[model samples]
Target chain A: MSDPYVKVRDLVTHYGTRQILNGVSVDVERGEIMVIMGGSGSGKSTLLRHMLGLERPTSGSIEILGREITTMSELDLYELSKKIGVAFQGGALFSSMTVGDNVMLPLQEHTKLPIDTMRIMMRMKLEVVDLAGFEGLMPSELSGGMVKRAAFARAVAMDPPLLFCDEPSAGLDPVVSRALDELILRLRDAMDMSIVVVTHELDSAFYIADRITVLDKGDILAIGTVEEVKNDSSERIQSLLNRKLREEEPDPDAYLARLTGTKL
Target chain B: MAADHETAGPARLVESLGRGTVRAVESFGYAASIFGETVKWILLGRRRGQAVRSGPIVSEMMDVGIEAIPIVTLLTFTIGVMLSIQGLDLLRPFGAEQQVGIGVALGVTREFAPLITGILVAGRSGSALAARIGFMTISEEVAALRVMGINPVRFLVAPALLAMLIMLPSLTVWADLVALIGGGLYISADLGMTMSAYVDQVLTTLEVDDVMHGIAKSAIFAVVITVIGVVEGSTVEGGAEGVGRATTSSVVKAISAIVLTDMFFVFAATR
Candidate 1:
């Protein structure tokens, strides 16, 4: 098989003495959506950071578009970043700048297009996210959903072939969340971009992900399609999927009293 | 058991020393990174001078010059008045109240005014720089800049350093004027010296070296303050607390470096 569009091999990441990702390995083909699902502290975000080259892995390597990102020089990595777009958690919009300025930043830095042309391109991207006239608004003026949409618009500003999104459905209502999921799907289909989404929302994951990787305690518990992950016999994955609560057995006296309907 | 205890005690001390050394080295590394980034951006600005000249430079002038003028003026005025008052009182005993003008003008124009103004600016603007950069560092904005194929230092520090270097001498000159006026007023009122007499004394006593020395020291001070602020701000970790600590430490370090450098200049110029 041809090399995957993005390949993560034995990725390990640490924060001080605590290991966030033990050994995460995954691959995504071109024009595919791969969702990394995990509970909090399951290393989903860490894995995504490694893939994006924002955080280097403590051990192992991440290859994006056939280049080892960890080993690449900063200049090379910056060039590589042009081919990739990332929608960070909370949208990560520059609070000081307006939406138009933020969206135009990458183009302004990397391209020599005329200002009027850049403005037209920026408006088009805003329109893609259904935020045509909101370009003049600051990040504070945007709702949570709008902020995410604006961030999405900025991420696709350059029409990158690869997109990474962290928790697209987070902090939004169900309707809005579904709308965002639909937008993600539309972007992938329209752009034919390989997408990697990090999230804990199973329903959203199932709706958007072509394949899913389940991380438990910094290790991948299962990797497959939604149906395959659901059917996997791994107890950890099963418990997480079912939302089973593990409660200790009650004391014998309490159990007996309850059964006999005695207050003593 | 005795041998084991002795070895453990020495081992712990060695480990502590090693840890401290590592932290210091890491700090130095962060400082170097910020410096390198600043230099890279400066070069970019030089290259892009033809294309994007006015916007970045104007923004920096607002940040470094317009924002800094009031504080520098206020401090210089206060220093001038206080120095004249103190000089009048001291010279009064010698029946040389006239010398108060010479003392205040020569001292302020030559040393105290610029040094004090530099320290104050370093504390104010330098700390703010550190805090701003530290906040950016923790927020991953620096990482974001890097990912965008933009060098963080060039994008952040270069403008700040360049703006300060450009504006500081002008600021020092303003401070000298304000201080001399303050000293003149003080000498006229407190020492009973005539305004004309005080002005004549100042004109006669003030040499070219005096003005040049103040401007030269201010340039050095600008470099020290800006570097410390940028370096400390970039090195910050651990979120808000880290930013706060870095700002405080940067101000202190900048002030200390200013004082030390001022002393060195004074010694060299006098010797």
Candidate 2:
């Protein structure tokens, strides 16, 4: 079998004295949509940062496309970063720039392509995110969904083989979230890119994840395909899934009342 | 709760002191690291035969130069009039009202213009630079730039340093001109000196060295303000309060550095 595109082994990270990721190990194959799902403060974001080479793991090793990122020089990292793209949770579009400028940033920095070609490529990327004509608009002018899409466009501008997104559906309506998930799947299949999404949303994770890595208290609880994770019968995963299911079920007040033998 | 708090007081105090010391050490380390990085980039840029890329430079020029022109001009004019008025008052006592022309011209061109402009820019633009970059650091935008393959110093500091290097001299020259004109008006009209006599006296008193001194001082002051602002801003921590503290400290440090450096320049020039 071919080696995984990204391999993280015994990764540990800390914020000062507080340990965040204890020893996370995961492998993501090429072209797969891997979801890192955990509750709040579960080190999911830290792991994502480690994977994207934003934060150095305190002890473990991260190899992206077989290069050890933790020890690489800054220039080498920069060169490697050109083949990878990231979409932050807040849609970190440069507030001072227009959507077009934001999308064209990587291309402008790394390529000497003619302006016309850059613009055409930028337009194509924007079109891929269903934002074909909103190129001139500033980030402040765009809606939350549009900002996410614009950020997505910028992430894919380099046509990187690996894409990392932190909380893709955060702060969006369910419909919009679903649309984003669909877009993620489309990008994966169409662009032939491997994607890693860090999220707490169960529905979003289940909807788009080809593989899921569940985290709890700085430890990986499970890492497997959707079916395997769902059917594993681990108490923590079951409880998490149950809690989500319980929250979604309608009107438990009547059931509680009947169980308690209380009269209205 | 009071009993428990009393029992924990010494331990808590020790812990707090320890944390504070650690933080101070960490901040010093960060500052050293940034200084080293700046030097490395300077070397790299020199080797590459290109100026370092800087976002802060463009933004600083827009904020400092374009936005500050009116206030700087106004202050220069006001200072000129005030200096002439004072010089006239003093000279009147000596029955030498005409000397006000020479006094105002010498003071404005050699000292007041550059000093006042430096202080103004240091207080206004320096604090703003500190606050903006500090907030950005807290927001992790600096880290974002790093991940995107752009050096923060190259992207943030180069522009600010370049802008101040260019703008401060320009501002000093403008301030010198405005101050002279305002002083000329005060001396000729208010103090009853003849326009041609005031003009000639001022012209005779003004030397090229006086202009050069002011511009040179302003340039040095600009470097001080930009360096302090960028350094403090880049070192900010703890979020909004940290940014606020950095801004305040940057202004204070820039002002102090400017004054001390100006005094050195004055001492050297006089010597």
Highest TM-score model number: 1
After superposing candidate 1, which stretches have Cα over 4 Å from the reference? A17-20, A245-264, B1-25, B44-54, B189-197, B268-270
Can you list each candidate's DockQ? 0.33, 0.34
Candidate 2 stretches greater than 4 Å from native: A244-264, B1-43, B46-60, B138-140, B231-253, B260-271
Per-residue alpha-carbon lDDT of candidate 2 for residues A109-142, written as tens digits (9 for 90 to 100): 7787999999999999999999999999999899
lDDT of each: 0.85, 0.86
In model 2, what are the clashing residue pairs, if there are any? B55-B155, B57-B159, B57-B160
What's the CA error at residue B81 for candidate 1, in Å?
A: 1.6
Per-model TM-score, in order, reads: 0.87, 0.86
TM-score, chain B, predicted structure 1 = 0.86
True contacts kept of each: 0.39, 0.29
- Give interface RMSD, per candidate: 3.2, 2.4
Which lDDT value does model 2 have at B104?
A: 90
Looking at model 2, give its docking quality level.
acceptable
Indicate the DockQ of the complex predicted as candidate 2.
0.34
